[model samples]
Target: MPGSITGTIVDPTGAAVAGARVRISHGDQSAEQEALSGDDGQYSLPNVTPGPFQLTITLVGFTTQASSGILRSGENYTVPQIAMPLATAVTEVRVVPSRVEVAEDQIKAQEKQRVLGVVPNFYVSYDHHAVPLAPKQKFELAWKTTVDPVSFGVTGAIAGIQQAQNDFSGYGQGAQGYGKRFGASYANFVASTYIGGAILPSLLKQDPRYFYKGAGSKRSRVLYAIANSVICKGDNGHWQANYSSILGSLAAGGISNLYYPAKNRDGAELTFENTLIGISESAAVNLLQEFFIRKLTRNIPNYEPVSP
Candidate 1:
């Protein structure tokens, strides 16, 4: 004679689990019986060979469960209600910004930086691990610097001084001379800024911004600042000779000869002299940035200090 097995399946909340698979197998026999739980979660297997048997219950989105028992011939064995726990779901998420996007964000922060809350300090990167800028960003920064009101004011001041000193005497006196001097000065500024800060840096894969070294002894910081005048961070993040600034100064000086009074143009001599002066100016400005400018700069991000 054969026996029967019956059971009800439920969820952890005790609600009926319909359409769940219920399978019964005997250890001694190679045969198995299977059934699907009804809408009320009831399931039954009739005429199952009686012996030692195991029941497995399976459903989507729930853990598989099993029960075991020994059945006597012609007995109706009922299993305790089986409750299936919900399966734990696993989900993975990843978020990452591209290098160009990161650089653009950093540039936006830098653009807000101003010295004494007035002058733009856009070329300085307070973030020690700042990402490299693309060629388009380089040009954008240069354009911003060139169009800044302070840049125009500084150029005007330089022109006024040159006019008072009669520095380029061939331009003569009065408003006409001042106009010529202003135009020449502004042209020089535009040429040098774009060439050194944008064009050459783009071509040479160099960074034009001065990276602040905020965690070091005064002497070490000073040396770093001076060295940076002739050596800059490469796009690859290694320090390399700053050929962009060096050559840019020479090129700007050579270009100035095209407009300057012939008497003032000293050819190659003037070019080299201007290049040396540019280097010296860079060193001085870098020193100011390391020691004093950061304190005076507004809208600066709270960046971690980098060690030497």
Candidate 2:
């Protein structure tokens, strides 16, 4: 003769839990029997084989419950009422920006940076662990620099000084001479800015921005700034030779020979000399940036200093 198992399921509040699944397994090698709790929270497993048996109760939104007992032939095994506890709830959240998106945001912040709120200081990054810019972003920065009002003003000043010194005597004098000088100066600016800051940097997978090292000894900072002229951070975030800026200076100088007077063009010699001068100028500017420029720069973000 077979036995039967019965049980009642309830929630923590002692309310009958309907639709709960109740299963009974015999200790012997026999199939398990299961039943659903009724509206009264009652469940029955009829015709279960006699012997040791286990009952398991389960419901959605509540923890599973289990009980064990032995049954005699033709016995009615009544399991005690099982009270199920509410299951613990869990949630997950994530909000991470892509590399390009992060770089774009950093670029927007950099564009707002100006020395004394007037000169564009867009090339420098105060964030030492700044993300690398895409090629399009590199060109965009170059374009912004070339079109800035201060860039034109600076180019005009350079032309005035050149005209006064008769440095490019080939251009002659008066307004026409000044106009030519201005055009030449502005051309140099555009070529160098695009070639070095955008074109070559994009090709060489290098970054053109000067990363500020605000946390270090004065000697170390100075050396870091000077060394940056010859070596720069690659897109991979590793330091490498700055072929972009070097070759860019040479390329820009060679392009100038086309517009410059025949007497003023020194060919490859002038190109190499100009490249060296550009590197020296970069070192000087970087030194100023490391020691003095940040204090004068406006709208700079409060970024943490990188490890020395």
Candidate 3:
């Protein structure tokens, strides 16, 4: 007849300890045998040599436990349940960056992005899980964009084009006309950028930056880009109507009339038309951002998608 050893192991809380290893050694100094605890925390070593023995139970995250007993021939020796204490060794460490610090880092990376390393592309967030910008940070970004050298150069170029085309003839073709056009163009840029991208965004707690949707079918991406002209993410992370952008466009257009020649003033209907045109332009720009601009942009961050 052969003897066998059997027992159940448990945690200090009395819950069964699965996957525990039980090693048994005889008092005669014979070789040891091992068995693994089942889901029920029960372990059995069949045909164990009959004799006094010691059992050592061990698991990865639990303290080792031991028991000793004598076995009779042909008997099923069931030892008392073994209790294991949780291991005190350090297992894992996690360091979470502060939200403000994270947003600052993201802003630093975004500030480095420029089209062809020249034109600032500061209004788009490639990170889908980007943190919301603080009000002060929002104003800082608008200021940087307006004052970048390329902005002035672009405004000058636009004024030259308007001069060549004689778009605002009441100003008359001359150096004076160019200066007036340039001032008006730059004013338009500053007002719209501050009102929409900084002031309104801060007040409404809405995110003014366009969020890139990089993963989708071509048609879906295109539609999403276009839809973003009318909808934007709120600071609360929900999508809502883009009231800041729409109202900002209208306000900038209205303000432009005050500085432009009297003959060039936009009527109420024309002002609304220009607003629609601005929205359309936003859609077009978003489309380019989705499919084209990132490639041309320098120093963009390699952001990975995070789980919601």
Candidate 4:
């Protein structure tokens, strides 16, 4: 005798799963029939044969489902609603900024940093693990520092002191002497900045920016700051001997002979001496940066300090 089977399909969320294919077959019989679920998720096999039967439901993007039951003759067999589990998505997504873009953003932030809201503190990077700068970016930073109005003012003040003290005697006294002194002083600044801060750093693949060590014991922080004057982070993010700075200072000092009054030009021995003095000054400045500069600096980014 013929019997009928009926059921509804739904998703795990309990929403109706429309258009699911439903099939039924009698045990020990080759006959099989199929029906699709409607908008209401209902499926029916009205002409199914009586006795034991197997029912299967399948849908695209969902796990196939099956059930078996015995149907009495002419019985209206009703199966429980079939819940279909959707297949897991196999897609992957990844988002990241390019290296150049990341470095550019970091440079923009660094350029805004100033000590006491007036002095440019662009050479220091509070982000110890900063991205490496490209050659172009290194040059750009050096150029910006060289042209800053504050830099010109500082150079003028130094030249004034030199004139007042009658230093660089070859240039003598008067407005002409002051002008020569000013030009020579500005030239020294430009040469040293470009050579040490940009050109050598780019060629040696070194980071020119001082990495601030803002946390740790006072002694350790002091040591870290002083050490940074001689040891610097490389483009590969490892500490290395600061050949860029050392060599750049030597180069700048050697170049200074060309522009400065011959009497002021330090010979090889005194040039080396002056280089040592410069390095000591760098160490002192770095110590100040670690202990005090950030507090006084305006527009500083909030970065967690890195430990040695």
Query: Residue-wise lDDT of candidate 3 within 1-308, one digit each (tens)?
Result: 66998999999899999999999998666789999999999999999888788999999999988899988889999998889999999868898988777888888889899999989999999998899998888898999899999999999999999999998788888899899889989999999999999999999988999898888688988999999999999999999999999998999999999988898899989999999999999999999999999889999899763322
lDDT of each: 0.93, 0.93, 0.91, 0.91
Among these predicted structures, which one has the highest TM-score?
1
Compared with the true structure, model 2 gives a TM-score of 0.73
Query: Over the full model, what C-alpha lDDT does candidate 4 score relative to the true structure?
Result: 0.91
Task: State in Å the error of residue 184, model 3.
Answer: 0.3
Residue-wise lDDT of candidate 1 within 1-308, one digit each (tens)?
89899989999999999999999888668588899999999999999887899999999899999999988899999999999999888788787999999999999899889999989999999998999999999999999889999989999999999999998999998999999999999999999999999999999999999999999788899999999999999999999999999998888888888999889876797689779988999999999999999999999999998974
Clashing pairs in 2: none
- Identify the runs in model 2 with alpha carbons over 4 angstroms from their true place: 1-93
> For candidate 3, which ten residues in a row score worst on lDDT?
299-308
lDDT computed for candidate 1: 0.93
Compute each candidate's TM-score over C-alphas: 0.75, 0.73, 0.68, 0.73
lDDT of 3 at 14: 95
RMSD of each: 7.9, 9.1, 9.6, 8.3
lDDT of 1 at 61: 95
Q: Report the C-alpha lDDT of model 4 over 251-295, residue by residue, as the tens digit.
A: 988998998887787899988998888889999999999999999
Query: Which runs in model 4 stand beyond 4 Å of their true positions?
Result: 1-34, 37-93
